[model samples]
Target: MKVSIITVVYNGAEHIRDCIESVLSQTYPDIEYIIIDGKSTDGTVAIVQAYGTKIARFVSEPDKGLYDAMNKGISMATGEVIGLLNADDFYRHDRVITNMVSLIEQTGSDAVYGDMLYVDRDDTQKLKRYWRSGWYSDNAFKWGWMPGHLSFFAKRTLYETCGLFRLDMKSAADYELLLRFIHKHKAKLSYMNEVTIVMRAGGISNSSLKNRLRANREDKLAWELNGLQPYFFTLWLKPLRKIRQYISKPPVKNAHS
Candidate 1:
């Protein structure tokens, strides 16, 4: 199956090259790589343009935000499956896409997701945390469990059926999307027990105490907007669950070390 990998970036000149190179280097030949830029003035567009036609599609324009750019990329995607990779993130290995497609075909599932590693922004080799996404359960969302969004690969039809990311949400849009897809809509999902993406340590939701609190409120609103009620402790458990990520480390050889 063909997979379309979308990278949404804004003024991310520093690391856009790494992200692009990672996608271009994928072992999967049927990948349609798309890059959506928010009219970056920091030479991010130039960096991406330097790749020329190697990038299947490139759009640089002013957008509402990260999720908006993602939406744009999704609308342009023609592949059978779609995956999102952030500008500051890269595939764990060259075969990440190859393995994802293989698993999807083998399991006959609508979606597939795997583990992720958060490495230092300056030194990617230095591990910051390990996000090991275990098997999915119907009630897992109640306990604040979600597969890594970067590692998530789903059919394009899922978005057309379930809907796209909410534009109003600041940080919890990804959380909300996953909740709707896996929980509310009950999309068939398969879990791969391996690391797929390596992300930069800092994330918007966990960037600061204030942002974290805001994200918590948005997360609760996510459930409310979907007409689904989460457990009273669900939001609380979400951040607390990260403790395990910090304590745990990826396997020595398997984590792209």
Candidate 2:
């Protein structure tokens, strides 16, 4: 099945090349690489153009924000499955997508996700922490168990039915989207228990104390938006959920590498 990997960026010239290369070098040949850039002043657009025909669709223009850019990419995606790879993150290996697609087909899941590493920006291999996404459970959402956004992939039809990211949600649009998918629609999501992507630390949500607080507020808002329970209490769940990252170990070297 064809999978569309979308990368959303704004003035991300520094890491855009590596991100595009990671998608292009995937062993899965059926991937459609789509990029949505927010009219970067840097050379991000030029770097993407170097790939030219290899990119199924590339657009550079002003956007509302990250979620808006992602929404635009989703609108242009034609593949059966869709995934997001932020400009600062990259696939773990060339075979990562190949294996993820296989697992999705084998398990007959509507969505699938794997583990990921939080690595230093300059030292990709020196993982700062492991994001171990345990297997899915019906009650997992209540406890804030979500796969890393960078590693999650869902069927395009799912997006069509559930709707795209909410531009109003400044930081937690992804959290809200996951809640709708797993809780409201009850999508069959599978956890592969293997690393699928590597993300550099310092994303907008956690970039600063103020942003982190904003993320917490947005997450609480997500709980209410999806018609879930205890919206206010959900704020405490965030810190507890993050503790798993430092405590889990990586998968076997041969299996993951």
TM-score of each: 0.96, 0.93
How many clashes in each candidate? Answer: 0, 0
Model 2 gets an lDDT of 0.85
Q: Which regions of candidate 2 fall more than 4 Å away from where they truly are?
A: 205-213, 231-233, 255-257
Residue lDDT tens for model 2, 176-210: 99888987899988887778888888766464678
Question: By TM-score, how accurate is candidate 1?
Answer: 0.96
lDDT values of the candidates? 0.91, 0.85
Q: Write the per-residue lDDT of candidate 1 for residues 1-257, one digit (tens) a residue.
A: 78899999999999999999999988789999999999999999999999999999999999999999999999999999999999999988888888888889998999999999999999999999999999998899999899989899999999999999999888889999999999999999999899999999886646578877888999999999999999999998988998899899797545332
